[model samples]
Target: MTERKYAIYDSETSGPRPRYDQIFQLAGILTDDSFAQVDQLNIRARRLPYVLPGPKALEVTNIDPYSLDSPEHYSPYEFAVEVHETFQRWAPAVFLGYNSIDFDEEIVRQMFWSNLLHPYITNTKGSMRADLLIMMRAYSACQPGAFVIPKNDEGKDSFRLEHIAPANGFENMQAHDALGDIYATAFMAKVCQQASPELWEHLLKLCQPRGCDEILSAPTCKLVTHFGVSETHLVTRLASNPTNPKQVCVFDLSVDPTPYLNLSARQIAERMRTDFRILRTVKTNSQPVLFHEGDKLAPEVTAEVTSGESNARLMAINDHPTFKIRVAEALSIRASEFEAAPHLEAKIYDGFPSRDDERLMREFHEAASWPQRKDIVARLQDSRMKQLGVRILMSEAPQVFDPAYRDKVKRGMLENRLMPPAEADLPWETFASARAGLAQVDDPELRARIETWLDEQEAAAQAVLAA
Candidate 1:
């Protein structure tokens, strides 16, 4: 018989965001840590405002708001009940997901919070949440082919998830739909299991580790409340680090930054077990900078702090942008660019007593501003919709093309087996070119030209018929 295996999970969404504006679909899955299938559950429910389905969503999920009957529509709470009941049967002690913490768990929590009249999150709070993506990330760090970019001759990686499966010897299955996502997560788990059998076995031993139900204590609840339902790599970094300071290695955990610090020199000393001194409190526009009034920064991570005999080290790194691990020894050697300089980068190196700062270090506090990066992952995810829009419009011009460009219009029409677009139909052009023309063209002149052209084309065709 298959080994006693399981994982419980689902995705929640107001929509696929970019792809579909239809009912937000939240899906869940249960599987063995190794991703041997056990059970699957999807919550196709939405409590969303009126927004048209994005071309991408319409293409991928093919959601139709007009088709379903009112009774057929599922509520958020109703979907959760379905998930809860399914879990009750398989009851995998552990919860598993891809990027459920930020995207999935966030939507799940909000759904329960809003829909269920007296909603109490049963699997929430200290629930045994695991991201296969994290396993993939850690595995990627140790193994090969973790990225999915297609770089030019520069020898850089331009890998995305669509290419990930093929790079690692798995097929890229139909994506965006619930089952397809489940299959991909399962595939990733399978890959991780194969790559690290020993670790996989260890994880299986604790499939639903003893602290599986820690939501009893409120911090576990924070896991869902914070709804870090982002991708796997981000979530794992959040895990394995506690929000307190200790004189441990900097590699033990990442430190976060905050508005003000509260740890005193003594408290800081106690945590680091090193002598603490006041750092220069150089204030700044964004965050307050504190230079080391003490000997140096954390010695375990950086070598500069270790050798500095003068306690005049700067307190920085709390708000370092990328959460990278820096060598303190390099700080003393590398002058201006390092933390001690007068510029914004240097001032950020100043120190702060750990507390809220430690908390910030432990979790990702800031979000990407305004427009998010349009990564290949997003583009590939929306591939279906992009194809749909391009195909449809490409099939029939929204307006007729120029009569002089009849061959161009005829080629497209024949290819799609559509009635050939007339000479007056809107002609195809690059999206940018079309937008520019629409922006500046004199509207009345454009209309007159189009009408005149249509009449001439019709008359010409009639003359030919008469001949």
Candidate 2:
């Protein structure tokens, strides 16, 4: 059997929105097949030129702006190069991170896109990605009482890393720090694996692309998976798609589709306009694991999916052949429409480029030094490709170029509208929203401190306006 290498990583970012936010700190802990520690990476990258750090995010991560400009820190371009190389070394390994699918993965994808590297590099090249948060939830369901459940200030069960880490015997000091979180996540994975080897093995298998395809393509009556914290172990059924098995639609079997089935096609369309979860689709490649109909599940897990009336409704729907066919048809139509309209952001972050573009990008990424890359890029005739090359070169190693070259690169970026325009009002709009959220803070002292920070930010903005 091949060695089962794994890379557990974490990133602390500038803000919540991945589109504009940039990662300032990133850390990873690599382990061999047996979960033995092998190598690690911890880096703090300088903030991107156009990105603004969120005040609350900065406070939580304790990322100082002045320190980000220090010699120790890597520029965004340099950081991208280093990260790409690090993952290449650990290529074909499972990329696992806590709540990474929703947040950290987006940050990484955007970083790669902006830096002209493969955005989904972690998932391609025989590699795969998984979210530890989902695994943890699965473990909790599969092996209840295996790990301690910690409550927060409200006395509600909290699954956040800081609380869960100490509960599972992992040191969690500097809880919000990227390196600390990486260590904690790795240790927690070990603990979960030790406690429930079977479930852990299942999760690991699900992390593989081939494994996901097999499981999703299998015959399933009713399956169980999670949507969010509140909707854990949601029962679903597969809706057929002849071509792309990867784009498998899983209907929420627990939801009563019987009421909607009685409606005409027009009424069903209207209902879809309101709430589309009459059926749900699972992109198996992205989210692989789902408990089969007859799989032995813990009582708590069963309770979550097999609810009282919902279970009965699903059984009824299953029994009615006509109902099942109609519901499937409706879901299939919706899935077809969704597939036709690909997300714009996805195009921007696609890992696979054209053969020619890939070859050039690979060459640029593999180039030994900045000057070598500049030389190769300067020879490119394609304006877009040239712009990408110059952008990466300028950002990654600005010190290598003289003032004139730098000016030309900046002008190119401006002409292409790659950089945010000086007069853009989005930042001010964000500031207003942040200020509104600050009013909800009940802690007088903390609120006062946040207000002071906000004032400084406003002054800085005013200075930019004056400039």
Candidate 3:
């Protein structure tokens, strides 16, 4: 059998929201299953024309946006392509990172989606995703003695990579730098693996969809989850979503199973809304931290509910097929309640592109000239793809369009950055918001530099509008 490889990565973005923000730097290190590094990558990109860098993000990363515009750096589209192709080459590997499942991974998907590339590359094509932050939470909850967990000022457990990595003997970690964080994450993963090999092995297996399904299939299991603090819930598989099999609802065995047995789907959903302890939705593909029935749990967690009680509740839940169906119905109802996404970038999950549209995406990337690419963009079947293709052309190759149309596109981009809509909730960073973010920066020198950049941007926007 070929040994599995892990691609541990980190990303530094212009802001928090993946839909509107952009990743300026992405770095990764590929290692064998044992965590021995085999290869590495570090790439930076120039900011897209429409993206105004958030002042707070710049303060954290200390990246000068002007510096990224040098000829040596890749354009945003080219950067996305390079990262996508490199990860594809390293396929069948586990894509692991610190808090990546929520933030970095979303940035990657948006980067691909905005550039007219396939968005689910990390979770598809024989690859899987994992988060070190989740792993640390599980470790701290289940086996606190196995490794050191740093405490914040409030004395609560701190899982930030910067705090925990250094506490576990990883030295000189550059917290927000993409490449530095990758090395720190790899170091911490190795520490966990070495400290408790059996637990590390189990958590690593849970990173796979099949492994999560297998563990949750047991009669009763321990689930380690975190919101602000880590918690271990003794839970049993209630039902898998009828529509999405990957989404499984688990019943907390600590609560008596008798009261919930007769409730209708609506009643159960009401109970779920009032108290999540009744039914928790777990995504099997999201690397949930689950342990088999016989696994050792933390002392306090074991005392929450005895094995006998948990098993009895599990038996009761398993015996009630009608209740399971009702819970599944409730899950569907809750899912349907969400409002439709307001923006094109937010509509990434609307549906998959047709095979023909997918083929056109490939052609768009491989086309010889800007005119050819523009023609291919016009032929795309999906509205999202068609719109995104136009954006790519405008950002990267506007020369193909007539001068008037090109100027119109430029003016529109400038207006979105410099002018705020009448609505208070602006999605992307505008000139006003960016300037406001500058007030929070304490370092005089850095604030001055960013202020100068913002002034230049304002001047440039005026010039384009006047043109």
What is the C-alpha lDDT profile of model 3 across 38-94, one tens digit per residue?
A: 988899998788888888788899798577577788988999999998898887798
Tell me the whole-model lDDT of each prediction, alpha carbons only: 0.35, 0.67, 0.85
> Which of the predicted structures, 2 or 3, would earn the higher lDDT when compared with the native?
3
Global lDDT of model 2: 0.67
Candidate 1, 350-387: lDDT as tens digits: 33314442332122112142112112112322232223
Each prediction's TM-score against the native? 0.41, 0.77, 0.94
Best by lDDT: 3
lDDT of 1 at 65: 33
**Ten residues in sequence with the least summed lDDT for candidate 3:** 294-303
Candidates 1 and 2 compared by TM-score, better number: 2
Model 2: how far is 47 from its true place, Å? 1.8
TM-score of 2: 0.77
Tell me model 3's lDDT, rounded to 2 decimals: 0.85
TM-score attained by model 3: 0.94
For candidate 1, the per-residue lDDT at 255 reads 23
Count clashes in each candidate, considering only residues at least 3 apart in sequence or on different chains: 57, 0, 0
